[model samples]
Target chain A: MALSLAQASDVVDAALLKARELGLRPLVITVLDPGGHPVVIKREDGAGILRPQISHAKAWGCLGTGSGGAAGARHATRDPAFFAALAAISEGRIASSRGGALIRDKEGNLIGSIGVSGDRPENDEAVAVAGVESADLVADVG
Target chain B: MALSLAQASDVVDAALLKARELGLRPLVITVLDPGGHPVVIKREDGAGILRPQISHAKAWGCLGTGSGGAAGARHATRDPAFFAALAAISEGRIASSRGGALIRDKEGNLIGSIGVSGDRPENDEAVAVAGVESADLVADVG
Candidate 1:
């Protein structure tokens, strides 16, 4: 089954709650369905205007690379030019960052992705993982 | 107040329901916040692959012009050159079509917009209007 809108909202809400509990800064979160289309997006009141764009890019990168954002960053490092070109082609919707994680169903089927932006890359990543787990879904951070 | 994720999902669901009731073909719908940022997007099974892109473009056009998609099309008709340049500048994220409608709050404040694709332009706009009203929001289709 595809990732439902309700599930996507839950993921964003759980991610925001985790960020608040951790005392992280305002954040923007985006969840994309398996088809790489946004299912839900939330930008906290104080989040930077660019946060939404960055969060979406991270999630799109995860979907495109078939891996989490961190892994996409590593892949970019090995071929920066290619990735850079890809970003241009995609209108900057591909990010090589550490704040995106793959979402999977109980059977380990890739369903979608969650992307967070605001705090340090590691903190963003941590919150994204927490958010995924809170929804009883698998987070493939690897 | 900003459009919440719940509201966005509700709009999508309502739109899909209306499409079903009308016996229209598969559709893709997109909702964008006031800032022209995506809130949610849904593509029904069997929709064309390009439906999402078209839906987003229609919503973005409405947001950019501060008018519904039908109005934007009229504007384009008056100045095709300008609209074409705008499409190029936006990297195809703006469409001059009739499948988009402005979303407003009870006080008539511009909140966001919804765009639907799949059926004829008029049919798409009709379903979008039904969906927005179903969510207890105003639809500016003129």
Candidate 2:
């Protein structure tokens, strides 16, 4: 099943609200569809001007690397040439760094991805995961 | 001096290479000039295609906000109303999110920005810094 834009936006809103309730300060949130395309993004107030881009980057990284955003770095470290080739083949679309996660179903099918930025990497992960969980989607995070 | 497309490509290449070496996966790397315009971008093979756009969005976000990149998100949080207005005025040019940073000179002059996507917020920051360091440019990460 594909994720609708409304659903994606709702997920982002839920995640941001959760972050605020937890006093996590402003955040950069993004949601991607099953193909890793951004559906919508929202930057919290005081989150900074760079937050939106950062959030999109993280989400894109997760979708590109096919793993949680933060884990992309670890994947790259395990294989350099392969990573380079991957980057090359993707036409500079794949990244393995941080602040992102793969969205999945309970059956383990890759559904989509979500990424958060503008705060601690761990915190970013938390907010993203919260959105996924709230959406009743399984978040494959490490 | 404006950064050439080749220079932007080099910045992204170096950043991705370093990120791979660091064992991080899921990163999106982007390079921009002093005007916060995209010069080059590489998304990695497995990285989602959306990463490239996210990188661009982050750089534009910084330029629109006049807060460089790092501090933009924080500013967004403190002044949501103003930020919203700015975002509206910029027509989605300003982001004020995470995963973006301002490129600086040794003298702390803002040269441009480097935005990283597909990773956790902090991890993205690290990779962006690596890209700038690879180019031997100064960076104000805020």
Candidate 3:
């Protein structure tokens, strides 16, 4: 099943609420369907300008690696050069880092990913987790 | 929705007026929304052929930094490696230094950014700021 625009908007809106609840900085959030196309992308007031692209890369990286950004982070640690080359191969789509999580249906089928940026890495991750869960989808922060 | 086309066009026109008033070189200007998509772009007659790309890069850089071009310039001067890597991450959409400003609403919500080229960095930035202000928007050069 594909992620709907309405669902994606809800995820982003919920993420913004969570970020506000946590007193974190304003954020940029993006949802990508399994096909690696963006379902929705939004930036909050005062969020960094590069946040949209950065968030896209984070979520896309999750899809490409088939794990929430965790797998990519591991690859970055285990083989720095190889991980560095990943960006070039992906044409700058992969940014192996935190703040990204996989979304899955009740049956555990991959839905896509939620990405948040504009704060500490862990804070960004927390917001993404909140977003995915808010949509009643499983969040694989892994 | 992103910044409206009419507003973007107004920004461009005002920037052009400012450039002429200051006796600056024929310039090119560009506006980009949060999604890093162009809203408007215009080049004055006799402007350098590269002005379009250069101005777009400057405005895009402002968005990438989550600030006006000034912060990016500071980053470039203080940390060339990090800035270079950032440029790579943004796929050359960023050109740090000047000629760009963040546009915000009265509530300080970032609407987009404007960029000007074909003059000295400060002069170009002034033109950009003037353009943003003409729309009754805040021009954040920081």
Candidate 4:
């Protein structure tokens, strides 16, 4: 089944709560459907001005590359020029970072993704994983 | 005060409710803060794949020109060249259409904007206005 709006909102809400509990900086969280369309986005009051855009790019990158944001970062590490060209082609919507995690169904099919921004890259990824798990979905962070 | 995330989501919720009440087609609704950053976006099931991007562009255009989408359309009509240049300069982020409306606070200061897509432009504008008003904000649609 496609990711429901209610599920997306739940993921974002859970992620934000996790961020607060961890004492991370204010965050921006975004959830995209399998087709790379945004379903929900939440920007905390004190988040950096660019956090929303960054979180969106991270999730878009996950959808575009069929990989988690951490995997994208690894790919970029090995091929900076190619990643840069990809970013240019996507109009800067792809971010090779660690805050994006792919969402999958029980059958192991890609469904959507969650992206979080505000803290260190690893911390962001951890929060995204927590959010995805909270929704009882698989997080394809690898 | 700036547009809060709660307020933005409320706008999207109200807009979608209106769309349903009007028997309009599935829609994509987007809200952008005054700085042109996305605060909330919701794409209904069956909405066209491009609706989110189109809605985002509409709202961004409204913020960029400090005018509602209808006014942007009028400006485009009067000076197509200038509008075209603007689209090019903004890397296709601006769309001069009739589905975007500026949001203002009680004091009449610009707060953000809402954009709706997936129907006739005028109908989209009507729905957006309904949403902004539902949130107790001004809808600058003139």
Give the best candidate by TM-score.
4
DockQ class, candidate 4:
medium
Model 2: per-residue Cα lDDT over B1-142, one tens digit each: 6666766777788888878887776666777787766677676755655566656666766655545556876776677667656655665455555667777767777778887777665677778777887787765655
Minimal lDDT window, size 10, model 4 chain A: A1-10
Candidate 3 structure, TM-score to reference: 0.64
Report, to 2 decimal places, the DockQ of model 3. 0.23
Runs in model 2 lying further than 4 Å from the true structure: A1-142, B107-109
Candidate 2 docking: what grade?
A: incorrect
Clashing pairs in 1: none
Give the C-alpha miss distance for residue A9 in model 4, angstroms: 2.2
What is candidate 2's lDDT per residue for A1-142, written digit by digit as tens? Answer: 5577877877888898889877887887878776757788888788888777667766666665466765676766864433443443344455555668887877877767788877777787888888888988877765
Candidate 1 Cα outliers beyond 4 Å, as residue runs: A1-10, A13-24, A33-35, A44-46, A72-91, B1-10, B20-24, B74-86
The CA lDDT at A129 in model 3 is: 90
TM-score per model over all chains:
0.77, 0.51, 0.64, 0.89
Best by DockQ: 4
Q: What is the C-alpha RMSD of each candidate to the true structure, in Å?
A: 3.7, 13.2, 5.4, 2.4
DockQ of every predicted complex:
0.27, 0.10, 0.23, 0.57
After the best TM-score superposition of candidate 2, give how far the Cα of residue B17 lies from its true spot, in angstroms. Answer: 2.1
TM-score of chain B of each: 0.95, 0.83, 0.94, 0.97
Q: State how far residue A46 of model 1 sits from its true place (Å).
A: 4.6
